[model samples]
Target: MKSLLLAVCLILALHCGEAAVTCETVAEDLYPCISYVAQGGSVPDTCCTGIRTLNSQAQTTEDRQSICRCIKSAMGGAPLDSINNALSLPAKCGVNLPFNPSPSTNCDSIN
Candidate 1:
């Protein structure tokens, strides 16, 4: 479970942008996710699916930022803020999320 959280965090950080992604970023994202889980909430399936797609598609800053935003939004408003606060990620990570993020969809499907 801990490792899964770590992976999720690392994936989120990496989705922030290649330059911004780091172990610290991973740690940052992890804190809030764990907190949310500890509060008896599960990480939304949409969030996980977003992260996975982001990890698979990440190649540029724009792509990363888009993915970050998608994941944050999937978590809904509060979790989004918590993720940003814990990760110290740029506000861009909060921008332009897709309306739908079904597991079968790709980043291109977001727009």
Candidate 2:
């Protein structure tokens, strides 16, 4: 049992590391913006920083699609009543996103 658990952990870690950009990574990178995205308020510099970083990091089409899926999933699960504010984050941060991040967005169609 212990060996199986360890193997599972190793496999998960390897999978995450292999992507270098995963759903967890997307969630983490955009975590700082949650408050602003959920509630209408001044977006923190850190949020913009994270957005910019996310933009730069997601260089490939695959990465962008994955990120879009991750973001959509996160937003879908968010407690916020409205995600309209979140939609403006990329533009506010001066970052252009290939796909819109919304609960209704089809992640598979991002590419």
> Candidate 1: TM-score?
0.33
Backbone clashes for every candidate come to: 0, 0
CA lDDT scores, all candidates in order: 0.43, 0.68
Per-model TM values vs. the true structure: 0.33, 0.74
Estimate, for each residue in 1-111, the C-alpha lDDT of model 1 and write its tens digit.
565465556555554533334334433433444544434444544444434433545455555555545454333433444444324322223423233333334544443
Q: Which lDDT value does model 2 have at 53?
A: 85
Using lDDT as the measure, the top candidate is 2
Error of 1 at 66 (Å): 1.4
lDDT of 1 at 67: 52
lDDT of 2 by residue, 1-111 (tens): 344334323433333433457766766677677668656688899989888888888877778777776666545544555367788888888888777878788767866
